[model samples]
Target: MGPGRYRFPVTPLAPGQAGPRPGGGPLAWIRAHPRACDTVLALAVFVAILVGAMAGPHGPHGPRFGERDLTVTTAVLAAVASGALAVRRRFPRSVLAVTGVCTVLELLLETEAPRAPVACSVVIALCTLAARTDRSTTWRVGALTVVVLTAAAMLFGARPWYAQENLGIFAWTGMAAAAGDAVRSRRAFVAAIRERAERAERTREEEARRRVAEERMRIARELHDVVAHHIALVNVQAGVASHVMDSRPDQAKQALAHVREASRSALDELRATVGLLRQSDDPRAPTEPTPGLAVLDHLIDGFVRAGLPVDLDVPRPADALPAAIDLTAYRIVQEALTNVHKHAGQGARATVRITRTADALTVTVLDDGTGPDGPDAPEPGGGHGLIGMRERVEALRGTVETGPRPTGGFRVHVRLPLHTTQATHQAGASGRSCRTGETG
Candidate 1:
């Protein structure tokens, strides 16, 4: 009834199914067939009542049977009281009412010497009702059964008001209600624990899926940066080699060499990025260190060689950036420059600037070329370069600004925190595997 406490319906087991009973035994079989158990219980109680009714401890020598005659009325009342118990679980309240009425009749009719053992069946039926129904209903029904039966035995029977038989009926009925309530409480507690465990398992599985998705995105961004950057340089160099193959033999050969170098670099990076998918114990896994500001010069040289002259300005800071921030900054600069080379028209130049503050490291890339608004702009969301950049920066809780400059050309400004959280450090470690390669 409380929040988040859901009660699911139980599904019945099919034939030959072990169900929840993996180790089947006597108790397991009894539990699996409730109606059969109830029937057996009812028959056993009937025999017990009849045996007790035919004997008494007031015998001359000791307790003995055959001293008192078993009358037809006594036999019929015992049979009726016990028979109703067989269907107690299906109709618990109705069974309890029938058993209680029979007990009252047996006590009232035997006025000369009352020895009604039908109260045994009433006790069993009351217990069944209490176990199946709620507390309020159990209290009301149990109290009524006890008061009625005890009053009948004391008022109409030959026994005194405070006789042991009258008191025993009240005690048995009260104990049955208490015992049944205990069983119901224990069952509810166990069910709640199982539901909690199942919910936790579902949460753990969802978290694993989320982590997998994040890893895939990280690998994708790394692959895009590596392939897009080097391939653009390769395409430019190959075109130059073809354009001046005859007129300028020396320039053509130099461009061919640059193309070879770019292609080799692209292959090495591709191999490293794909190697992340391999098992950790793989022998051919790449061990190359990830690129950052330390290799900015090498990255710029490749662009300058591909006919895009670039100006770089970076000041050394007091402390180094965190691995994640350093990697993100390097990738952003790489991606922004790659975009410039691919979309900017001929004779366009780019400027790269790095500014370090107390808490942040900012990298700005500006190109004096056709911006996104120009005819050369890629369609919105069509380019994965910017999307990858945004994802990387956001992962480290950084910011990225990309738009056209006020005067002309396109600009990409990114601010990365020098000191990142522990979660960012862990992400950097995971991503390091895919980013490891030779950038040259």
Candidate 2:
């Protein structure tokens, strides 16, 4: 035998048998064998009816067994009525009609005071009919059964029309219908509860999948921003080092040093971003703080060293900004400056400006270079920098605009709420508003 394979004995099952269901107790056994249960019920009802037919209240003391003879006719009618109950669930109306006929005959043909025990089977049949049918049908059939049986017993029985036995027939049948209706209602209520629970389970699973997809998108955007900005710097420096290795040895050494620094920064940022997906118990995971607007000066210096001079204008806020807004602001500036360094022609200087209002913080990046529509523009589908910027802004309920400037340059502008509560307030009013023109 193969290591992953096994053999087991095959047992044959009887036709119409599906093996035992998973459960226990007497109720489970009854549910598994309904036909056998119905047979037992019929036997019990037959015995009770036969015993009742052999007893009478005409005894000197009270009702006594054998006071009345159990004739062949009485026994035959009792057997017929009880036998009909075996198929009550499958054909409730038919069973009820058969039992009612037997009961009518036993009442109308009796020579003495009628003690028709066959009516017991009719009671059971009426209950089954009501339980298996709708309320309107149950009501209609129940009223007819009660009226017909009670009237037959009153008008044709040896006893008077108002005898206690006549009225007892009406009471028993009415109670059976009510009990059956209650059982039907309980079953319906339980079914409704089960359906609602299943719907809630499906809803929770869908919500979990949606959140997982969003998180993946966010991580992908972070990895892209980190790699593109640092790798662009490294590429430029490596080119400079190779071009001047023989002619300008000292300048080549300087360019190589910048390349090492940019690569180191890239590795550190990548480790931190990737570490978020590791297990909490992993000891090698990095715990460095996320970069934000506070490091704007250092970010700009890297670009300046890479040969693209940049100008900065920012004022310190009175209070610290939220963590999400701070990170988004930093990434937007990093990606925009990286685009300028890579695509903007030689001597194409860039400018970054930050303005803080009472309720909002705005960031604007401009470069006097060949814009997206210019001859130097990269082909369509070249990058996702502008798309990532829009996604980050929209997540915080902010707005972003990207396009070619009128005066032969490119522009990236964004407005973010100062307070988290303000973002929540405006989220419904202007949902996911992002105005984009072209990618760099």
Candidate 3:
């Protein structure tokens, strides 16, 4: 309501009701007894001024009040100024107005001393407002108060316009505004820092969850490749052994042995997959080898026994393939063969070819039989087996093409870039080797 003195809605403690628990802190005490606290503060300001009036230097060894006891009017003015301060925090603008009027009256009327005590209390109130509010409000209100009060002191005071006491009033008010604004700035900075830290923590949690989901999808793909291929072969061989057990004993025994080997391969791959989940505290993983393109012959051996003849042609590079690409290629072949077993009927012949060019490694699997797919079937990412191959290839920025072959079967073609992937893998391995050597 007054210049810069914004009125805060002070909710007083309810009558006869116990407030917040005592000893909660200074803030709690003030809230619990707002009126009482304001009274104490006002009285303290009055006493401090009274002491200054008594002990402060007077005109050439004369009484500050000019040989007179405290006059009734002067005493009343002092009381008014002190009492107005009781609601200074709740109504700073109003308090400043009341105290400003009182100070001007003291300058115009009081004879012996014009350096008023009410002015000091006004400075304290202005400081509180600046700290709680914005800079524009504080500066506007503080400037208006300074110009009006300083001009009043010069025109109607006992002292001259250039008096040291007059200048002191200007300096103290400016200092109060500056100090309060500094406090406001500090609080805002701390709040911003806290907000940023909370947001970063939330982001980290989201990233961790995303990585976990990606890992789960990868593991499911691997299990599908290992279990599906081996289990299909084992099922077919078991059927063969049962069929021949009565007619040819030697043939049945051979088929039963093939079943045993297929089961064993499945278990080994499953264990290798499960080993990835072991914690650091667990014993080391089984030293069993992972499958790769180099093992294509042995892989074809199992399929040949299952009655699906496979032709494998893989030319080994002078330098081995990156572990990831090698493993992915092996899986692609395995999944392709499993699909042939499931979809292509008897008399199917599959040809798996791995060819390396200047920039890429290509893999193609073609099977001829009554393959269970139309020419319109989707490629790569849209289907199950093709989806796994697409995900693996695309991770390395490679490509996959799959569809029903016009000649009479299904065809899968994969091409993976070698230069970038192999280089990165070599750098990583080199770094690890250097670290190991240093540790030794």
Candidate 4:
């Protein structure tokens, strides 16, 4: 959201946007021209068989498979099957069928053919099929092909029915199918994990956006409360000064002085609120500490000087109050005093009482101003001061109560929990975590 998004240089480049890769590696080449891969594989098998046939003395081999010869049929069949492998991915089933038939032909004709069996090409094709197809298709085709090939070898070839050579063919084919299936399974698992990670990243971004929106709403409320309270005072004082400009020069001068005081306070608070919008590293940011209950006397003094005398009572806390609760308490008191000065008629008296306990803190403001029913809430649509106070209190898991006093004017009450949920948990595990408040 901030410059942090662009501060990192590593994520600037797009994937695959880097320079070209070096000429294709074996796997890349295979993927690019799979048919060529098949052809190469088939040729390798043919060469191995050819080398095996002439491994001993060429003219009359001393140690050979059966006969020392390079036959035409074996070469052609190996070539055909391996060449067919290139399109195995697109037609896995069809390629398996073709390669299987070729393998059967080679095994059946082994009696009259050369000593070499180029069966490796057929094995490769079957593996490709197994990797591409589902389990049922792979099992049915794989089992049938292995059985048919091994049976053909046992029935027509020189090897006996249970010969190790015949069994070796079964072993190789079975392993190929299993290995292909394993590769497919591993790929699917990795894909699933990648998809899950992407979903989690999206969820995290959505959560961040929600939090940012909530913070902006809170800042808007704070700005409204600060501006509304001081501006109301300034407006009232300015009206008084204007009304008495020619009639009572002394009273007009006093009203003008009050107007200046109210305007200066408003400007100072506005500057503080604006400074909060600055970057933390900015030198122009305000260095003044936030107002709290510690400044309650000075705050009430302003109202007293404004003609509405306030009886204040607050106790010193034995344990330090949490910063959020302290600031919220101060704001609630300030807003209440501001409303009393605005809506309360002349000769009105206000009383402020704060009770601090081991577990919680309570603030009450009662004003017998003999004015409207509810000053803070003059209409059906409530004023911003009460709403801001409620928001601040509720955000810290606190509650607020405001209504008309039974006998006379308005009453404002608020309760703030000293120990948060996390703090409560800590106190339960530790001993005597909270301290009692001192009476003042």
Name the candidate that leads on lDDT.
Answer: 2
Candidate 1: how many backbone clashes?
A: 0
Model 1, span 235-284: residue lDDT tens: 88898899999999999999999999999989988998899999899999
**Clash pairs for candidate 1:** none
Error of 2 at 183 (Å): 2.2
TM-score of each: 0.85, 0.82, 0.72, 0.70
Task: Indicate the worst ten consecutive residues by lDDT in candidate 4.
Answer: 431-440
Number of clashes found in candidate 4? 2
Q: What 10-residue stretch in candidate 2 is worst by lDDT?
A: 9-18
Candidate 4: where are CA atoms >4 Å away? 1-84, 91-98, 101-122, 129-158, 161-164, 185-215, 340-350, 367-383, 402-411, 421-440
Candidate 3 global CA lDDT score: 0.72
Per TM-score, the best of the predicted structures is 1
Candidate models: Cα lDDT each: 0.81, 0.82, 0.72, 0.69
Q: Which pairs clash in model 3?
A: 5-93
Error of 2 at 423 (Å): 11
lDDT of 3 by residue, 158-245 (tens): 4777786677777887888788778667665655555566666666667666556666767777777788789888887887899899
- Candidate 4 structure quality by residue, lDDT tens digits, 1-440: 33244221122222111222347777666666666766666567656656654444333535545445656777677677766776776777888787878777776665664232555666877788777667787789889878887777667654446665567677888888898777666655655655566666666668667556666665666576677766766776777788888999888898778878877877887788778779999999989877788887877876776677899888865677776777778888888877777776667889999999878889999899876454443443445667667667766667778888989888899998887876543321121211221110
Better model by lDDT, 3 or 4? 3
Which residue ranges in model 2 land beyond 4 Å of their true spot?
1-23, 57-62, 71-80, 281-283, 371-379, 418-440
Local accuracy of candidate 2 as per-residue lDDT tens digits, 1-440: 22353433333333212334457999788978889999999999999998988887567887789777788888899889889899988889999999999999998777675766888999999988887778898899999999999898888764777877788888999999898887677666655655566666666667666556666777788898999999999998998999999999999999999999999999999999999899899999887778988899999999999998899999965688877788889999999999898877677889999999888889999999873455745676667778778878887878888877888778889999776676453332222324553453
